[model samples]
Structures are given as structure tokens and as C-alpha cells.
Target: MRAYETRRGARLSAALMLALAVGACGGSTEKAEGEKPHAAAADYERGPHRGRMLRDGDFALEITLYEEGPAPLFRLYAYQNDKPLDPKGVQVNIALTRLGPKVDRFTFAPEADYLTSPAIVHEPHSFDVAVSAARAGRTHKWTYASYEGRTTITAEAARAGGVTTERAGSAMLGETLPLNGRIEITPEGKSDVVARYPGRVVSMGVELGERVRRGQVLARVESSESLQTYSVTAPISGVIVEKNVTVGGITGGQPMLVIADPTQLHAEFFLYPRDAERVRVGQPVEVTSLAGDHRLASRIEAILPTADLTNQTLVAHVPLSGPTETWRPGLGVKGTVSVGANAAPLAVRTKAIQPFRDFEVVYAKVGNTYEVRMLEIGRRTPEWTEVLGGLEPGTEYVVDGAFLIRADIEKSGASHDH
Candidate 1:
């Protein structure tokens, strides 16, 4: 009975393998045949005019795009047996199907030497084309694909590749002023420890850079007049930045120690004469460290009325809030002050912008396909860019991993051709 069961199981396994093989072969064959029609244009023959050449026996047609004039327009030339054919004798029509399955139809009119399309051929010269010609009561038709700045990836693949998208729409565009500054402790956050009277330091308990609490004993001072010793306590909880007095050192009016609270920090940005009028207190400022490893969102707290006598630059104080463990006094920082703002009808994430051909574009996604949208940009900030034209509102665009899509499209050998 055991032997019989084993033989039956072997037969079942063999059947399953055969079924999978047949399914795989059928799917592959179907996919190849389906792609052939679209793949033909990439391998189409080119005529002398550098346009795609479509031929049937002794009759041939050459299509070219004439863009040296006002706008891009299609020009067609006809031939018979390697000799020129009269453009008036042949009637032609062309259809272009774009990525969104939108179709554009064009009709040709005969000119002096060739037939020219009256309608302009829009940019991205990337589409599947269908051509029809009628001559002597016979009709000839050919279909091929030409694509550029476009690519198609499966949804699963796009997700795995980190390709994310967001709809393009209204955004607040802010105009900013660039300012350079350094982190500094607020005046109220720093303290200078001094003795009540002229005295000599008896025993110093706290060292430089030591963390101390308010009312904590920091040192023992013996007064020269009273002839007695008194404990000197910290006025504020902070780190000791300067220790001027050592044991047995005489302390008079000078500060014996300086303590600064790191948490009470602010960035001091300098404004030149041109920028002084634009900046005001309460304006939002984005401060970043010189190394760019840290960033904090702050606002201008105050603007000094007087300018520095040396450089004549005014100072704007922007207070840093939240956890400031990484912010250190005297650390150089850069700031962008949002002076003014306007609402733009269409905007996209600045990082989504990519260079495509002669245009700065963002990849608009529809389903599994991605295509470029050339932009006429307006005022731009580091986070968002205003779109003046060339993209429709509410269109989904790639916010991240846009380079991956561009790379895939380039790797597919898409080109700009007539």
C-alpha cells in the first residue's frame, strides 16, 4: 500500500510541473506578440530627411518635423521608385496616441514641394503613430511607436523601488531672505558669578564645563574685610563656561565664573542694508547648522535698532526652541527668513523636479506609467516650487524616487524624434 501511494504522489508532482511550464510558455508568447506592434517603430527605417520612412512596394513616404520656424509642424514628402512624387496627388493623415491614451489627429495639405501639417506637433514627440495615405484609389497604412521621457513600471515594482506620488495643486509660496548667523546664549540665560565683597577664593568645587544647579554651592570665598568664609552658590542651573578664579586667587569686582544655559539659545542673524527693511520680528526663519546635520524652525524674536559700527549690518535675533542639545554657542548657522508669500495655483515638491532635455520637469504618474511635464516655474523655495504652466492641477506626480523613473526611461532608449 505504501509503494502504491508513493507512485501516485510522483505522478501528481509531474502533472503539476507540466501545468506550470505550459502556463509560463503561453503567457510569454502572448506578451511578445502583443509587444511587437508597439516595438516596430523603434526599428523603423529612416529616410534621407531623417524622418521615419514608410514604404509599400514602389511607393514610399518620408515624414519630417519642421521646427526652425515658429513651432514644430510635420512635413511629408512622397516618392515613387526612388523618384519624387507630387504631394498634391497623395492624401495623408496621421494619428498620435499619447501616454494617457489621448489621441491627436493631423491632416496634411500640399505645399510647393511637400505636404505640411497645419496643426502644430506638441513637445515630447513621444507617442505611438498611425499613418494613412491614399493615392490612385488605393490606401496604405502603417503603425509604429515612438516614445521619449516616458516609462512604464508595474505597481508592485514601483512601490518596491520607493517611487511615491502626490497630486499637484495650490501651495503657499514664500519669498525668503538668505542670512548668515551664529548660535548664541540669550542675555538672560547667562550669569557671571561674583563675590559680595573683595575676597580670596578658598576652595573651588566646580570645574569649567561642569553642570550645576541653581543654589548649588560652587565655591568657598573668604572675605578680606570680614575675615570669614562663605559658600558661593550657583545663581542659575547651567554649564560653567569660564572659571577665572582659582583657589587662593583674589576676587574683586570681576566675575569669578561664567555659566551659560544651553537650552536658552538663540541664533543671531545679520542683515545688510538691503535686507533690513524686509525682515521684521515674528517672521518665520529656518535655521540650519553649517554642517547641515541639524535644523530648527524658529522665528525672529527681536531686531536691534542700531547697526554695528564696524560692518554696519543690523542684527536679527531668532530664538531656538525645543530640544537644543545639539545647538552650541558660537556655532555658525544659516537662516532663511520668510519675508513674503503668495498662493500659487499649482506647485510641486522641489525635490521632484528633474532635468529632462531642455526643460525642468516633474514626472506625472497615471497608473503604472510615468511621463514628464515641462514647467514654467515662478517663485521657488527649498521645499516647494511654483508652477506657472505646462502641468495640469490635481495631476499626480512623483515626489520621491523620480531619478529612478528617469533612469528607467533613459535606459529604455526613448528619444525625441519626428
Candidate 2:
């Protein structure tokens, strides 16, 4: 299944290759006189400063992104004929067109031995770069692509691949306490049918496992004192779980039938000493069957004051509603109780988070393109995760099928080359 999904993603990627070309920065389509096009930044030769070297005859400029400090900034080293050139002697301007077609322009000023860009280079560092420099009445220009953690897919293809998106915004993040329990019938939902007076059973009307309604005749008993026959009816509407009498059997002292209402059920979850203090009545809980195939949303209906002598744990009862076909008495269940919640200024769906390289990332969407946004995360719950940094609040991000984007980017061999 994984291989087939990957193939589908590859097809989608192929369909967007043409779109990528229009925004591609590799191999210059236009250049100045006597200037030649260069390969992408990944293939460019690194100068002594470890920055990509762009050359036009004897004049060359090495561009490096300096990030050792608080923020990333652009730095340029000028050279002539393999020898260092005076920084002040060269004038340079750079344009970076990001995935959203948003352009960031930077002008370089001579700083120490190299020209520096005062503006900070934002994260992702993936863009189409255009560099122009002038010195000694001569001009040099170059353009190349430097893309990483980015991929493009047509809208049609995205829908076909189940790709979905949502805007990053405020959300309530909850803190939960986990507990284990089992489904049980409520006390009021069960009843034991018995004869009103000592008598002999004349006829049994219901069998084990048979559903019955309240006041339905369960057995006909012949009273010993009156020496007359009377009907014993079900006290509650439920299924007959136990039948203790038959025709011609003596009743009165023992229950003739035991009926239990399956619909009125509750999950009794055990809270250890450490977690008991945090749980209270009326808090919401999410209960799932032991097999995890069924789930029900409920709230803590009550908490027993006394602890069980065997386990020394208090019981928290969560009432279950809706269809009870999957929830049977004695079936074990898992529960998550919401103890508290806090509002987060900016958050994203937890499902959108994916591991990219060394950081936890989510793919931000713009048109047909998607790029990684490494996040600084804070409090997290199963539904929403607080985003402390690396993403804008109103930005649209992939909420599903993010793995496909990551796979496509990896297939393109996008790297962190300087």
C-alpha cells in the first residue's frame, strides 16, 4: 500500500514539473552581455568562505548566508583573478523570490572584509536567487535555484491524493488523564423479578437473553395462601440475563428472572492514588474499547468516595450514550479524561506535524506549492498543538497527506547546501 501511494504521489509530482519550471531558478534564461548561465546553487563551487561562488570572467563574488548569530543574514566576498578585491569597490543587489512569489530584495554594504546584507534571511532558505554586481565600470549577473523542503502539486492532483489544508490559528489545547475501565450496567437499569407471594410456578413466559418490557408477564405463579394463580411481571424493560424458575418450580423465596438494561451503561474507570486527585465529576472523557474499534464520548457522572480494598483505587463512572451494540458489559475500555484546557494564540492540528530532517515541521501551502516550516512547539494535545514559532497564524498548512509532500521533496534530492 505504501509503495502504491508513493507511486501516486510521484505521478502528481510529474504533473507539476511544468509549473516548477516557470518558477525554477536553475540555468539562467536571461543574462547580461558576456555573462554565462550557471548550474543550481547545489552544484556551484564553494569559495574559501564556504559560500557559492558566482563568476563572470575575472570578477567573482562568493555569497554566504551567515547564521551563527541570532538571525540569518547574507554576506558577500568579492574577488578578482583569484585575489581578494576591496569590498567597497563592488556594488551588489540580490533578489530572492520565494514559493509564494513574494520577493525579498537585499542591498549589500561593505562590512569589514565582506559586503553584508542588513536584512535577515528568513527560514526555509528555499528560493530563486538573482544576483547583480558592478565594479570598475563592468557588470556581472547570475540566477540560480536554491530549493529545499519544497514541492509543487496541481490542485486536481492534490485532491486526488487526499491532500487537505487548514489555516493555522487559535485553539484550545486540553490536558488529559488516562484511565482503564470496563462497561457495566447501571444499578437502576437492572431488576430481579420475584413472585409477590410464596407460590408454585405454573408457567414461564420469558427465556434467558430474551428482551422484555416493564410489566410484561415473566411467569404465572399459584399463590400458596390464596391458592390462586397470579402473574409476575418484569420490573424494568430489559433483557432477561438470568432465569431461575421453570414451570411447576417453586418460586417466592428466589428471583424468577433477572433483567438488565444494556442501553443504560456506564464505564467504571479506576484512578490510582496519583491521578485520583485530578479527576472530578462532570469532566469530559473519551472512552474507547479495548480493541480500539469503538469509541464513545461521555462525561464523568460520579466518583466513588471509597477506594477498592483490592486495588486501593477510586472508581470514576462515565455514562455512555448512543448505540450500545459495540459496548457490552464486562468489556474493557480505555478512557482519557480532560482535566484542564488552555487557549493557545497560534496552533495547528496535531495530525499535520511531521518529522523533517532534525526538526518537527508542517507543510505550509501557497497556491500549488508547499514548503516546510520548522516549528518551535509548546503544549500539545491529541487534537491541537501550540505553535510557538516558525509559522504565521493565518497561513494555510497541509492537515492531511503531508507525508506525500515530504516524499516528493525527498525524491527531488532537495538538500541543505550552502
**Candidate number with greatest lDDT:** 2
TM-score of each: 0.81, 0.72
In every candidate, how many clashes are there?
0, 1
Candidate 2 residue pairs in backbone clash:
25-145
Q: lDDT of each prediction vs. the true structure?
A: 0.78, 0.81
Candidate 2 local lDDT, 108-186, one digit each (tens): 8998999998898887787778899999998888876676787667787677777899999999999998899889999
Candidate 1 residue lDDT tens string, 140-237: 77666555676566666566566789999999988999999898999999999999878989999999999999999999999999989998989999
Error of 1 at 199 (Å): 3.3
RMSD of each: 10.0, 6.2
